[model samples]
Structure formats: structure tokens, C-alpha cells
Target chain A: MSKEKIRELKKKIEALVIAIPRELEAYEFYLDLAEKSADDAPSKEMFMFLAKQELFHRDHLEKMMNDLQSQLEEELKKGK
Target chain B: MLPLKKLIVHTHHIATHFTNALFPVSAALITLYLITDKPSFETACYYSMIFGLMSIPVAYGSGFYDWRTRFQGRRTFIFDHKVVFGIIFLILASIVVIWRSYDGGIMYSVGLNKWLYVTLVYSLTGIATWLGYLGGKFI
Candidate 1:
């Protein structure tokens, strides 16, 4: 409701936004690993599995961002 | 005389090394992309996966053939572990690929939760690495 609280929420949103890309990078990296190990059947499979998992993390972060955005909007409305 | 068996073996050797060489580079690219947020690095990561995926069946096929022909009916611990891990990896890889296909190849899109995803990835990587270690011992 207060200016200070709104600023803090905005900062948290920024942090979450920054984190989303990092998660994407991780997902790509694991996929890359999986691709490389593909020749080594078992290793490749494992990496591919890991890559998928990373993708899921990135998606989760994105959902969190969406939730935070809605909350921020609600807070701003309350302040108004 | 370059027999078919020897030729297949040689092919497998090359395929294995080629695949192995790609791993660290892929890992590095991923790390770089994460830290720098560079699209160029991400491109490299995609390239690595493409090449690696192409090579998987070759390696797996050759390895499976060798196992069946050479180690048939001998359930050694190492051999068994390799087979089981290999299958697990395949299943996981399939799921990953299918998910990616549906998600339009964007990792940061909607689907599962963070904790579960992290746990699964870390666990899979650990297991894969262990499988590689066991493979090295046998090789």
C-alpha cells in the first residue's frame, strides 16, 4: 500500500524477471549436454532427461512471475 | 581384413568419442549463456544438441549389438547397470524431447514446477555421470 512497499514489490518482480532467463540458460545447457552425450546412448538419454527438467524449472519461474505481476497490479490498485 | 564386425566396432568407437567431446562444450555453452545471456551462446547450445542427438542411436545401436553378441546371458553387475541406466536415459530423453516439441522449444514456458524439475534434472545428471563412470571402468 505504501510507496516503500510498492518499490519493494517492484524490485522483487525485477529479480524474478532476471531469474527467468537464467533458468532458460540452464535448460538450454542441459539440453546441450544431452545432445552431446547422445552418442553415448545412456549419457545422452540422461542429459536429455535433465534438459527437460530444466525446461520445467524455467516454466515454473515464468508462472511465478505472472503471479507476482498480478499481485503487483492488485497492490497498485489498492494504493490508488 | 576389415570385416563387418571390426568395421562396426570402429564406427562405434568414433561415435562414442565424438559424442563425448560434445558434452563439455555443451556444458560450457549452457554455462556461458546462463551467465552472459548471449543468444550466440544459446545457438551453440542448440547446435551441440542437434549433433549429439543424431549420434545417440548410432552409439546405442552399436553398443547394444556388442552387448548382445559378446555378453549374452552373463548378467554382470556393470553390464546390468549400463543397460538399466541406458534405458532410463532413453525414456527420460524421449520425455524431454516430447515436452520441448510441445512447448515450442522454449525452456521458460509454462508446464511443471521448479522444485520437481530441479530435483529430476539434478538426479538425472548425477545418474548419467555415474553411468559414464561405470562405462569408463568397463571400457
Candidate 2:
């Protein structure tokens, strides 16, 4: 791959690095809400659902990141 | 410079422009959602906003990198406004995303919250325009 392409990949990885934490934070926020609303069964269930959704998001993002990282490494090795 | 740092310095414009482009699409999508009352439009708008939210940090990070490297970290008026407003835009976008996530029916609901959600989505376009204008001035 060309240098420009490598740079683009790096930029994408940087974005994922920033985004992953946000998904985790969202997960934590909902988890905390879920715990607090234990007595309110419906609200607690809703919060747990949201928390799971966030975890799913995080997992999806992490998969993307991993795919990108492997591609970046492969390209770097080819360049070398 | 290292490849990573070089990318940060050279790609701020690309990052910022990409982010600016996404917000308008998001704004328009949300407006269409309200007008047509279509669930798909709302879903598209939500995805656009999520994409926009993710890209903002990339833009903000690259802009900071460019400022520190190219401009010697000067605190000029335009830069100051961009930094402050950039942060504000991020916060507003996050609120809309989180609120919608918590309540899927927010857009359909009839209340101050629904209007507020719409207002926030529209405000994204205004903020993005201002940021783009300021960015142009910087160059």
C-alpha cells in the first residue's frame, strides 16, 4: 500500500481508539442506572437492555478496530 | 516526523470537512424524519448522528495536532472560538444520541423533549457551518 493509504488507516485507527472508550462509558452509565433501579423491574430491565446494547456496540467497534489493525500491519510489512 | 504524527498534522482539514459533511446529512435526515414521520428516516438520522459523534473527536484531535505543530499552539481568536464551539458541538451531539438511545420514542413523543431533540439536531448544522467558516478563516 501507498504511504497515503497507510496514513488513512492510521487515522481510522485513531478514531476507533477514541470511540471504544465512549462505548464503554455508555455501557457503564447504563449498568449503573440498571443497578440503581433494581426495585423498579421495568426500568431496571430497560437499563440492562441499554447496557447490553452498548456492550454490543463496543464489541462491534472493537471488531472493526481489530480488522483495521491487522490490515495496517499487513500493509506495513509489505512496505518494509 | 513519524508517519502517525504527520497524518495528524496533514489531515485535519480532511477530518474536519468529513465531520462537517456528516452533521448536515444528520440534520436533514432528522428533519425528514419529523416531516414524513418515518421510522427508517429516524433510524438513518440516528446512525448519521452516531457517525458524526465518532468523527468529531477525530476532527478535534487532528485540529489540535495541526494547531500545535503548524501554528506553534497560538491562542488566536478564531482558534479559541473553534475550540470552544467544537467542544459544545460534541456535547450537544452526545446528548441527542444518548437521549435517543434511552428513549426510542422520543422523536414521536409530544412534549418539550421532542422539540428540544429536534432543536438540538438542527443546531448541529448551524454549529458545523460556523466551525467550517472559522476553519476556512484559519487557513
True contacts kept of each: 0.00, 0.00
Per-model TM-score, in order, reads: 0.51, 0.60
Worst 10 residues of 1 chain B by lDDT: B113-122
* TM-score of candidate 2 against the unseen true structure: 0.60
For residues A1-80, what per-residue lDDT tens digits would candidate 1 score against the true structure?
Answer: 87887777676666564456556557778887887776799988888788788778878877886787788788899988
Give the Å shift of residue B127 in candidate 1. 4.2
Off by over 4 Å in 2: A1-80, B1-5
Write one digit per residue (lDDT tens) for candidate 2, span A1-80.
68998888877776665567568768988998999998999999999999999999989988998898899889999998
Candidate 1 lDDT, tens digit per residue, B1-139? 6656656766766776555555445556656765896767756755664565567688778877755643433344566687888777656545543543454335343445423433343444555576677657534
Candidate 1, residue A16: lDDT = 60
Clashes by residue pair, model 2: none
lDDT of 2 at A77: 95
The CAPRI class of candidate 1 is incorrect
